[model samples]
Target chain A: MTEKLRIVQMGLGPIGNKVTQYLAERPNLEIVGAIDTDPAKVGQDVGVLAGLAPLGVIVTADIDAALGGGRADVVVLTTASSMAKVHDQLLRILPYGVSVVSSCEELSYPWQTQPELAASIDRAAKKSNAAVLATGVNPGFLMDFLPAAMTGVCRKVRKVTVERIQDATFRRIPFQKKIGAGLTVEEFYKKVEEGVLRHVGLTESMHLIAARLGWQLDKTEDIITPIIAERRVTTDSMVIEAGNVLGVQQLGRGIMGGEEVISLVFRAAIGEPGARDRIVIDGEPAIDSCINGGVNGDVATCAILVNAIPVVAKARPGLRTMADIEPITCW
Target chain B: MTEKLRIVQMGLGPIGNKVTQYLAERPNLEIVGAIDTDPAKVGQDVGVLAGLAPLGVIVTADIDAALGGGRADVVVLTTASSMAKVHDQLLRILPYGVSVVSSCEELSYPWQTQPELAASIDRAAKKSNAAVLATGVNPGFLMDFLPAAMTGVCRKVRKVTVERIQDATFRRIPFQKKIGAGLTVEEFYKKVEEGVLRHVGLTESMHLIAARLGWQLDKTEDIITPIIAERRVTTDSMVIEAGNVLGVQQLGRGIMGGEEVISLVFRAAIGEPGARDRIVIDGEPAIDSCINGGVNGDVATCAILVNAIPVVAKARPGLRTMADIEPITCW
Candidate 1:
């Protein structure tokens, strides 16, 4: 909107790579730099890394340099949701009063889930008088905006529930490992004991929704057990043994005032076939929407962040979470 | 299991009264005592309050005597979810090592949403070597159990959404007031400001869900506004002003990892007709269930609580939420 905005893209992961591709053609947007921990590819041409045309952009871990020297106008982070590291990178640009948009789950329930990290980000954002916005597809768009938008069709609501099912064999490799793709039940239990193997994004989505909606989600719970395929299967190049590879299934439920209001479920594996999502509303003029596959989740989330840059840029600067405002429209 | 389990029913509200009636003639359960805040009904017989045969159970607000001096084995709390003070009552019954279950939303998210209260109650329960469980119809049965059971059907999944809607004019009074039924847009906003009116519940549901499912919901938001009637209508007792006295529609969404996994929405109002709820899953073996609202969710939550006592009573300690234990049979 203002003479071709400069932006920094973080992480060279699948979504990050996809984001670069999406942003490549936008005349008003320019990639000043890129960040990733892939040591082998550091200092490599980001355009080639993102599978796009030559843009002269290089992937580097030098977040500070990317923030300063007028390297970029805004920082677009698509890193891990725990991205407390993003907070540090965000600070370097904040003092310059630069705006930041991220696909970080940490920003949603920053206080309750990550209080210290959230407080630090908040302090830095306020001190620099720069704007910060966190959003993404699953945690950003559908969880927060789709439901809010659905209220338009109903007259009265007694309860609301959200259900999502995903098959991640089509997703990138890292996601497969992250969700425990080739693990036995015994190994899965071991990982659970160590508290490291599991899905990572949906929890933040719930936080964003609750804060905006003003319902007190008093209790939440999830049951995670790896789902190994009943039959042997193989992926693009990998052979998933009959019971060696995980046919993962994860389901989480939430209760408010002793009543269950929401459920978050995900399943991913190497040989899984397809994916689907559905929503049902129980009011006058009841509504239901069921769709197939991932359906622009992360892409939509990227759009939400890019579109909301203007809104955050206009609003007051501070450590703002979903609780501080509504599931606003970027338009 | 133990001679019709002497059960003490608390808060003789509409829900409490209905649950008492629902279980009135059951041979395995007995109403031993009752509690309420109303002074007028303080000494009245519980059976007479529900217009049933006299069981000689008297209602009182004195929680101490109600559970102290070796009284009932378990206390069924159906008090208002807004009463944070009542949660403290949950801790008192435990010193006698008396197991307790409540329909309190506060107890559901006591640790995350209301940590201080959850901690204090946790300490109280620890001192008493007792266990506590909370649940209800929507947040309890449908949101928590139905989805958990649906896990058996899916081999792989990507996202999930749940929905519930009910007409409030057909519902009881407390629900209408709490959901801000029959109000204009300006009036609804005013109530949200007053903190006296709210959609109630979903927040805790989302919170518990994220924690239990092992995904980190870093950001969440709610989309709620006013729902005016499209046309003029009249209810059994209340007059409609065309666009007034209809009800409010609400939605809450939770997303994880840049993908929308859980989408929850519902409708509820009294001025209209009947109430209904449904669950729709999106996996290879998808699920769909629509239930009529005859279960009386308010009281059914209490039933959910009482029903869970069997499993929770035997569960390990240290702040165990719903997913921590196996699903107990209440049907």
Candidate 2:
């Protein structure tokens, strides 16, 4: 019998827990270890922490012990959103010669914002002969990779536009609160200026698409605004009065030779009436495609990470982005 | 500079003409020869035949001469719709040690219908160390491949359903006629029973999806019904009375373990009010996605075929399907 691939789940946050739960059920993958900084979760059984029947593997706080313990072919890292916060954590894993697939939004395309750090990660991955990749539904799939793939059907593409509207009512409480729901417009702007109430990585998505299409961008801009609630609304966890901030509406654009070649719009709010994902390409035989309901964040993020494990395992040893990989096949 | 990939265009039908036109514009590909049986088109410049500015290469009727011409690495076959008709043509090209990407619907997945022909093609491809694949917009992408890729985001998929409703008024006259528009119900049924008036390859798509998901289908069914015009409709070519057939509606289902595991519905006719493509997966988190305007067939089919050339050129030797290929990358 072919031996199952061993996987270590790093971090036990909501996304991490979901990834672990899904990975535990795969016949081809075995969850060998789990890590989390939470004292409450450190000693719990991984299966229990993931809300599954006990599978005997335990969560630990020691990253080194988790890495040193037996064989782990890949590590699914969902620790933090930024690469800066996870740089050391990733550095610690590379030496163990285990591939890593993280959910860091900024790491999805780090050439513009964190080139030096990306280079360091590349060197570390090469030295250890391991692959590293960052992916999520928004920056990785919907906005960048999917739009780029759609252009494969075009002979000469003039412009690309992608829009993602998500209703936060069905999401977890943490996500609902992240969009500054229920905050006043002034308060929302203050929080946005303080870096606490804004979506990250739209610029990264623009850069990724531009680079893939071989367009040298003159400039890239990101604009964020508050979507004020017109009517009182209540989600599963929070209540928002009329005139309060419903959520955030963010737009990013990549201008090439004075033309806007790439445009991306992401809106996540409490009371979006019709939430969907749309991509339009203005080229030969213009394409207008819409996904009626946008991808489910928690579920799809976990699914993409788990699905990427096998691809990363077989990938060339280096720090790779979504574009660098061959076609991503689930089967 | 690296040498460009040499390509040969076979069959100057609407799809073939579009493929040639698109490929002529790519920097990495060079059109070396063109072949068609039409007496009027045999000696015309390939570009002019494709309705573009004249290219230097002239169209030819001699298949052997075209195959023997210099450095024809791949042949884009669009001559016939069925594998039985295209098998000899594929055999003739394989011995020339050139890869092929055909738009043949039956060749998409012929294991159930023409297993012997498929095996023979596989043997020929293996002997020549070349790859051959059949793909297009509907059977290849919208119904089969795209849905399978979406399942990557699913942990446990219970059932998959894809619906494509295309507005046929924008389509060409031949396509409108193929759907039996302007014909009475009796005439439409007679043509369908004679195997000349129905959409092809939904069964192949069903088989492809089931195989990718690893489901053993108990039985598969295909149902063809006429989409009678509700109101008087006039396309560019023909006018349909209120009671005449406007187009065709085809439905295919795959039953597995006493349940329908895969369902595909394709409706292409005059005056579809809200034409779109939708896919739903009843699995973890339940995915619902819709493409506002179903894929533009004429343009996308050509683009997909031209895009597939490089993939087929680099693939392992066999009668390969989309499922067997490593993720298909556009750039």
Candidate 3:
């Protein structure tokens, strides 16, 4: 019998729970360890924490103990949003020689934003002979990878634009709150200036597309603005009055030689008319594609993380970006 | 300095000419030889044949001379529409240790139609340590590869359907004539029965999708029907009277355990309201995607061939299908 690939779940948040639940059902993948810092979750059954039947494996906070057995081949890390917050944790895990697939938005293309930390991670991964990749739906796949793949049909690509719109009212409470769904416009601007409200990774996506196209971008910009509610909007946990901020409208652009070569627009708001993901490539024989209903973020993020495990395991050992790896597939 | 990848272009048909034109402009790719059977094109400049300025390389009809010098690393073959017609050509090239990327539609997944020939090609490729791949925009990318890639976002895929519609009036005269654009309905049916008309790769696309998803199909079917012209239509050289055939509507389906798991529909006619490509997956969190303004076949086929040259060169030695190779990318 062939040995199943062993996977360690390193976080127990909503997305992490989704990943664990999905991975538990795959016959070829075995969940070997579960780790989290929360006191309540540290001693719970991993399966139960994932809202599934108990699989007999217990969650623990000890990273070294979980990895010391050498049974774990890959770690699905969803503990943080930024690479800075997860840098030390990666340092702790890479030495075990286990590959990692994380959901860190900033880590998706860290070389563009955190060059020093990206190099450090690369060095550590190389020392351990383990490959590392960061990916998610918005920043990694839909807005970046998909656009780059579409350009495969073009003989000469002059411009690429991607637009993603989602109705946040159907999302979870944390996601709703992250978008400042019930805040006043004044407060929304305050949070935006405080660097706590805007969406992350738009600029990272821009840089990624530019690099894939071999364009040396002279300028890259990301701007965020509030999407105000036109009428009363209510979700299961929150209510937004008219004139209050509904969500965010963010745009990122990469300029090269005075031309906007890459552009990404993301909108997550309440009561949007017709949510979809669209990409337009301008060149010889232009292309325009749209997904009538955009991909579900929570589910897609987990699916990509799980699907990427086998890919990362086969990748070259080091810190890798999506562009550096093979085109992602069902395997 | 790194050595450029050497490429040999075979068959200077409409698509082959486009491939040569695109490959000539790439800095990382160098055109080493061009081959065509036409007496008029045998000694002409390859660039002029491609409607471009002179590229110093002349067209040749000598296959041995092209491969004997070891200057060619890959051959882009666009000679025929079926593997049976191109099998000997592939055998000749593979033994030279030069990888091949062909546009033969039936070769896309020959295990379904020509298993014997497929295995022979595989053995030849393995013995020579050379890889062989057959790909085009329709069978290789838009229908099979793209749909398979979209499933990476799903935890479970129950059914997959792809719809591609093209406006044939924009295509070249040969393509327009191939679709029986000026033929009557009776003539179209006769041509279809005679195997002179209809799309070639829908069944291949179905098999490719099934292989990727690991589904054992119990039954597969391909159906063809004429799209009657609603009104009089005229192209650059021909005209179709009202009540005549506009083009062909082809459908292919794969069934497993009495359930239709894979479905493909393609429509290319003289006049259509909208020309786009759409895919729908019925599974957890269903997905609907549409490419508004479908991919241009001529341009995309050339782009895919040129882009796949490097991939085929680096692939495992065998008769590899699109599903067997790494995810198709711009590289």
Q: For model 3, what TM-score is found for chain B?
A: 0.95
Ranking by lDDT: 3, 2, 1
Expressed as tens digits, the lDDT of each residue in A1-331 for candidate 2 is 1578899999898889889888987788999888998999999999998889998988999988998955799999999988888788999999999999999998999987789999999999999999999987877888987787777666668999999999887777788789888899989999999998878789889888877666778999999998998888877787889999888899998998889888899999887767888888888768787777777877777888887777788777899888666444344
TM-score for the second chain in candidate 2? 0.96
Q: Which CAPRI category fits model 1?
A: incorrect
For residues A100-121, could you state the per-residue lDDT of candidate 3 as single tens digits? Answer: 9999999999887899999999
List clashing residue pairs in candidate 2: A290-B290, A290-B292, A292-B290, A327-B327
RMSD (CA, angstroms), candidate 3: 2.6
TM-score of chain A of each: 0.83, 0.95, 0.96
Predicted structure with the largest lDDT when compared to the true one: 3
Q: Score candidate 2 by lDDT.
A: 0.85
lDDT of model 1, residue B293: 49
- Model 3 gets an lDDT of 0.86
Per-candidate local distance difference test:
0.62, 0.85, 0.86
* Residue-by-residue lDDT tens digits, candidate 1, A70-148: 6676777777667577777666667867777777776755655677877887778888777677766556544444443
Which should have the higher TM-score, number 2 or number 3?
Answer: 3
All models, DockQ values?
0.02, 0.38, 0.52
iRMSD value for model 1 = 16.2
Instruction: Put down candidate 1 lDDT per residue, B1-331, tens digits, no spaces.
Output: 5456667888788777866765565566777778887998899988888889877888888877776777576667777675376666665566767666777765665556778777777777777666676766656545544444333223233455667777677666667767766677678778878866655666666665555443467655666666677766666655656566466666767777777666667666654454555556664334454544423555445445655654455544534455444334321
